[model samples]
Target chain A: MVMMNKEDFKTILKKDKKIIDRAFEEKFKDDNPLNEALRYATDSGKRIRPILFLESYKMLTKKSYLNDEIIEMALNIEMIHAYSLVHDDLPSMDNDDLRRGKPTVHKKFGEDIAILIGDSLLNLAFENSLNLAKNGQRFLDASLYLSKASGIDGMIKGQVYDLRRNLEIDLSYILEVYKNKTSRLFMAACVMAGLLNGLSEDKLKALENYAYYLGLSFQIQDDLLDKNEKNELNILSCKSLDEANSLLLDFNNKAKENINKFKNNDFHIYLIDYLTERTK
Target chain B: MVMMNKEDFKTILKKDKKIIDRAFEEKFKDDNPLNEALRYATDSGKRIRPILFLESYKMLTKKSYLNDEIIEMALNIEMIHAYSLVHDDLPSMDNDDLRRGKPTVHKKFGEDIAILIGDSLLNLAFENSLNLAKNGQRFLDASLYLSKASGIDGMIKGQVYDLRRNLEIDLSYILEVYKNKTSRLFMAACVMAGLLNGLSEDKLKALENYAYYLGLSFQIQDDLLDKNEKNELNILSCKSLDEANSLLLDFNNKAKENINKFKNNDFHIYLIDYLTERTK
Candidate 1:
């Protein structure tokens, strides 16, 4: 396996982020109030989902360059993420006044517009996918995988479980919330890599496993970092911080193990390292 | 064209309603809380959108039977409508406790679940569309049409506009709102019939025009009936009831004109007649 150094990793991340940024700019070319509000809502983010998506695409397809259709796929995932964040921050939900060091969409542009912004963003995600359907059945095939990951049995269900957080829940139930809330969308991005390029079944299963561990590790890290959360409180009360960190390390190690099973997996291995060590 | 008696029209409505009811039942066969909530929200509507969808499809294709793809297409429309109502009746939006003489989703399921219900329904609509994409590119083609008609520039924008309802707005502005909030989805359903069956440009254009007028007449009738809306209140204050009815007649006349342009038009004409004359 060819290894990617730190510079190679930065280059990949920067290029992927630029593609996603360009797609958003192009999709929002028309200046309307709804678009304006959507722009504000999606204005800032780490773009982690798109990064994972593009990297997975590259790793599976062995293609360094991405096409408009694939880029749009990445954008749709981010839009789904953006909209979920917007809704999750609403007064009736998490009541978060700030996100990513800026005021939440609801706080910036009234709650009503925020709701519409979230709704519009969700619709736009599908709009982008349907637009890509002109390319072939593969994009359409990938989109089914995507919508389920975002829907009732996936991310939204996780949000429901998260919102209805209970203090009495044990580690097992909290893990269920983490799987839905944090792991599913990430898993979709990773699995979409193989689904897009028609990766073999064994390799595809490996990617899915890779994504599962990646998501689990990421969520445990999130819980460890968050200063205020009912599950966080429950987590800390149930186990020691050191124990949580040990579990996270175990998941991270498992994520790396899946990556190592594939040929030409240097960059993917680098990605796992970056995510596991990511500060925020 | 075979001219139908009132009994035939009633007969068609009942049969179509039963098909839509079956589709929803089969779609929501899962007994999860989320599906249960979706079932409750989807139940008891007039099922107008799906009825129009099937009627339009039948008129264009001259087919008596609907495959699962077509039925799924119809279900997607009703899901959009159902979810929109669920969101609209939220405390943050319309705050209505009752809909169709039953407690609203939020009232019965709680606000967070209501929000998830709406989000999940939206995702399910796309999931169903993605599933139907396997039938052919036409379903994908129609899905692009469907998403745009539901997205930022369409129904959601209209909802934003409606939420910020201004009493000072004129009839022209109200018409714009009606076109976005009401006409686009109905127009999508109508135009999709031609898109799915690959109708000629002339026929498709007529379908669009037909839907435009259908939506206008329907919303105008809705406003004319509702005693609580600001625009309705404004209309009552500004003009005589007879003058408002005259405008309704003009739209209703325009709707019939478009339907008459089609060759196989008996039931389409009857559907329009029923919509305009129905007391409910």
Candidate 2:
């Protein structure tokens, strides 16, 4: 297997980011309040989720290029992510005014439009998924995987637990919050790649495990880096800084181990380190 | 054709409402905050959208009974409608303190949970739709139809129009808002029924027209009956009360005519009058 250096990883991610950004540009060209705010909310991100999806698919298919349907599916995942961030920033939620160095959706558009923007983005994600599914059964499975990950059994449940954080919190409860809120979508990204490519059930399960560990470690790293005191569900609340770091290291190791069975997995292995070891 | 009186209409509606309510009761049996608030948000809706879907399907299949998948799809439509109402009643949106003689979701369970509830319900709607679609191709088509009807091309766009109501509006603008916000879901209900039953494009077009006219008349009647003055896009703003009433009559007649071609459509025909002629 060919090993990829950090520069190669950056190059591939940049190319993938360009693909996602261009798709968003083309899809949201109309100048309306909904599209404007949608474009604004989705404008700039690391494209981490879509990149993970694309890399997973590439690892399996050995294809350097992807079809529009695959890219559209990845964009749908990003749209779900974008919508979550938009709603999370609402005054009644996280109540942040700034995101990505600009006013959030509710701050730029009115709260009504901001709420609709989030709802619209989520609906649009499924609309695109359904359209992609019309192509074949694999797409349908992928869409279902995504829908499950984002709904009550997954991300939404995580958000609910996070909101009720003050009620008899424990290490298990905080871990549950991280697993559902963060890891579910990560699992969706990877498992969707497996579903779309018709990977084996064994491989799909492995991908899910990889994503779960990756998500937990990445979230813990986020909490570690965040200077804000509002996150009562942070790992530090349950474990000391040293304990959190050791847990992060253990999770990062597990994440790499899960993907080691796949060929040409240097990028995936490096990704665990990159995501969980971010600088301030 | 079997001619039905108001008693039969009430009987069938009550039966269908029971089906929906029981499904909700079963689905939301968990006592967590999310399920509790979800049940509260969806508890007493009139089950209008789902009923429209079931009746349209019955019109095509001529079957007195439906399967669980079909019922689930119908429930999904209601879930989407319920989510819309929850979000619409948020403090940032319509700001209603009460709905159906009970506290709104945001009023009863804080604004944050209400937002998550709306997001969860919408996500849950598509999740159920995707699950139902796994039965066959027809269900997939039905799911796609519903998705488009609820997204930016449909309900969300209508909301944006409603939010931007003060922007140099006119009769056409108000009608645009009504068509998208009100009629789109009605169209989805009927069109999904047609799709699931493999109705010809001609019949689907007829169903679409029927739903459009029915929704317009329904909204006009609602505006006519509402004693509040907050609706800037109410038809009465441009038309006299007599003129608005005449227009409602015209749309109601059109609605009935579109569905008249189908045999055993008395229930559908009566639905228009039942919805438009609600007593204050």
Candidate 3:
């Protein structure tokens, strides 16, 4: 298995950036504040979630179905991701002025527009998912999966838990938050992509497990990064990269064991290496 | 046509309150700030939206399907309504301290919890809607209808428009806001009830028209009520309700004519009277 280098990932990111920009222009109308806010939020980000989705899908299938519709779907996921970030960055929440080295949506626009744009992106995600009529049932299932992951039962619930108490919650409680806040959507992405390509249920389930662990590892890595920053003003407490990397190794071992249940492929090995070893 | 007196409406409200309380208790397990915030936002509301849904359904169907599931459905709609109210009451928006004769959710539980609880209620609305499977397609359609109506393209979009600019918006703009903010969900309620009992498409459409007019009138009345309340701060410098009501009369006349297409049942007549003549 050939590992994907940083340059290759950067190339993918660059290509996706162009596609996302075009999708943003088409989906969001001219100068609409909601659209503008969404665009501003999406543009400033690293496009991590969509990249993870596409890369994982490509790893399993060994096919890159890059089209307008797929690009749009990916773009919509990014929009939802961006919307959550905007809402998370609100003055009442994290209250950050800068995100990804750009003015946050609420800072650039007003809070009102930021809220609406976040909302518009959420709805637009459904709208985008509904466009997958080539496989209607798959589309519906994917839409439902994404909706459940993004809604209160998932990310919102985690957010609610975070806000409701001040105690240092246990690892189990934190894992619940991580599952809802991070893992479920990633799982949805993998499962949906597999479903779209007519993967077997067993294979889809295996992919879901892999994605779930990947998500857990991703979040732990994020926590580690934030801890390294150690800014008192930072909303999230971060840990050192070494600590995060060690946890990632544990999570990666679990993911690798899960993935081994399926057919062996170079793509799968590449994915493991890319996700576990690569730094963004 | 005999009018539906306040007593009848109050009876329905009481029933709704009982169900809503039960559902609220079931959803929130912990008595943390988040649960309290959600309760603060939801409890003590008039339950007007759910009442409208049930009463309209009852009037059209002439059957008492006020089962636990139906009541739950009604409660779900109110939860969505309540969630929107909490978000609307945030310091970044209307920033109101008092709602329904008590301190608002943000005032009681802080802004972060208020936002999370609002998101939680929205998710719970969908979860609750899943329980309406006994009504089959009617319930599914109703839930979907409510979801779309409350979503960004519906009420949230109108709010976005309202907050974007402070200029004197035209009657068209105002109508857009009113239609999205009020009429769409009201229309969904009527349509949902009509569908529940297998009403004809023509009748459902007519009922929707009636609901649209009623919603417009309701908004006008609410604006007037707010304007008359000397203690409340004015959010907008809008035209008087008398002027708005005059325009609403045009729509109300059309609704009345549409109502005549249905059978001359006492319930239908009562609905028309209540909708057309009610000040609050």
Candidate 4:
């Protein structure tokens, strides 16, 4: 597998971050806590999902359009991701104080505002995606995809299962949780990018497979990093990186085959390598 | 003003409660805390919004179709309303333990589950609405109206404004908040019903004005109830009931004119009287 340096990845990620910042400014005009909560929640992240979306879109279309509509869509996705994180870190949930080396939304703006901000972000996501539809079927499709990913059939249900059940560490249950919580949205992102590019169903399916595996691998790496024996990261202790990595390897092999079916890009090869090799 | 006896109002409310109960059972299959949170949040309310919608529709069309789809749509609205109440009762928000004479959602099922349940309910509302859209364009318009009422430019943003500032009380600020927080959804409910009945635009506009004033009067009543000096329910001590009642009287007069434009129903007249005269 080819490896791409961290510098190149950072460059692309930075460009996406710039786009996200501009979009936030455009969509939220009121200088209130809603905007501040959004800014705080969004600015803390590494922009991983948006970067993946951009990369996958680039793979399919080989060109980027940083227009207002596209940027808004991208930001909307990022904001939803951030909002989920904020709610996840609430005192009643994971009870996390820090996210991505910063205070969580509830920590900074209080829980009421954080709750409203999260709710607002979710609503804004559909509002922004509706614009992408421009009075067409695509807008409807985008809204459907987003609603499904975040709805009971997807992330929220996954989280409910996580909270309700005792950790037996079953492979299937863990895999299902990961697929629903992490991979579903990631898959949607790639599918949406493919849709934007007007790619064939076959190609979109292939890209979805790629994203699914990439998400598994990425999550496993996170589990590994948080499981440092030297200094516990205080994440979930019931899961192991070895188990996670084994699952990732199985999925990654299938994803690589799909990615390979598309035109070979040096960046794609590097992404796969970086994702697979990352310790954190 | 025709004042309905308490027994009559209770009977109507009971019927409405049964409809909402059956809808809840059908929609939420899992009998876990997640489901319980939703049920607890929704089950005990007055069903004022759904009743308003159905009543408004009957006024315009003189035909009642209490089909599964209409019931589901009405339940969906209540669920959305319930979700907002759950979030609003969080410890970092209003921190209220009681709602409608029982434990609030967060109190009953920890804040995390409450938050997630609220999110789930909001998404399910859309899912339910989308199912109704299979009926026709009218359903789509209703869905859009629902979306607008609950979205950032509506209730959620208004909540944000309330949370962000400890402002000196002013009529304009109060009115703006009332419009966004309470009146918008109530107006949407009325308009949706009007759409269902194929009401003329002029009639719809008149109904909207009626609903808006009704909402304002209801909110003033609510604010006054919370300021019950004798009962010591000092949730908001900044304003007195006399002051709030003065505003309510003005709004009630305006709403009375709008209400007269529609052919009168005893229930409608009774509602206006009950809202105007009820004590905490």
| i-RMS, each model, one decimal | 1.1, 1.4, 4.3, 2.8
TM-score for candidate 3, please give it: 0.82
Candidate 2 residue-wise lDDT, B1-280, digit = tens:
5788989988999999999999888998875558888888888978989999999888789998989988899888998899999999898788899899999999999999999999999998878887877788898889889998998888988988787776677778888899999999999999999998898999899999999999999899888888475754688888899999899989998998889878889889889989998866
When 3 and 4 are scored with lDDT, the better candidate is: 4
Q: Which prediction has the highest TM-score against the true structure?
A: 2
Among residues 3 or more apart in sequence or in different chains, the pairs in candidate 1 whose N, CA or C atoms overlap within 3 Å are: none
- Give the lDDT of residue A261 in candidate 4: 76
Tens-digit lDDT track for model 4 on A6-97? 68766766777676666666656676446656666666556667766767767666565555555555675686677788788888788788
How do these models rank on DockQ, best leading?
Answer: 1, 2, 4, 3
lDDT of 1 by residue, A1-280 (tens): 4577889888878877777776777667686658777877776677888888888888777778888778889888899999999988888788889998999998988887888888889998888888877778778778888899999888988787777766577777777877887788888898887888887888878888888888877777766666366533345556688988888888888888888887777766776667767776
Candidate 3, residues B1-280, lDDT tens digits: the string is: 3455667655655775676677766766674435555656666765567777777766765676667777777777787778778888888887789887788888888887776677667656654564453346666667766767777678887777666644756667777888888788778777777777778888888888877887776676566556665432222345555666676667767767777776533443454456556564
DockQ of each: 0.76, 0.75, 0.30, 0.41
**Model 1 DockQ, alpha carbons vs. true complex:** 0.76
- Better model by lDDT: candidate 1 vs candidate 4: 1
Q: TM-scores across all candidates?
A: 0.95, 0.98, 0.82, 0.85
After aligning candidate 1 to the native by TM-score, how far in Å is the CA of B215 from where it should be? Answer: 0.7
TM-score of chain A of each: 0.94, 0.97, 0.83, 0.86
Off by over 4 Å in 1: A166-168, A227-234, B166-168, B228-239
Question: How do these models rank on lDDT, best leading?
Answer: 2, 1, 4, 3
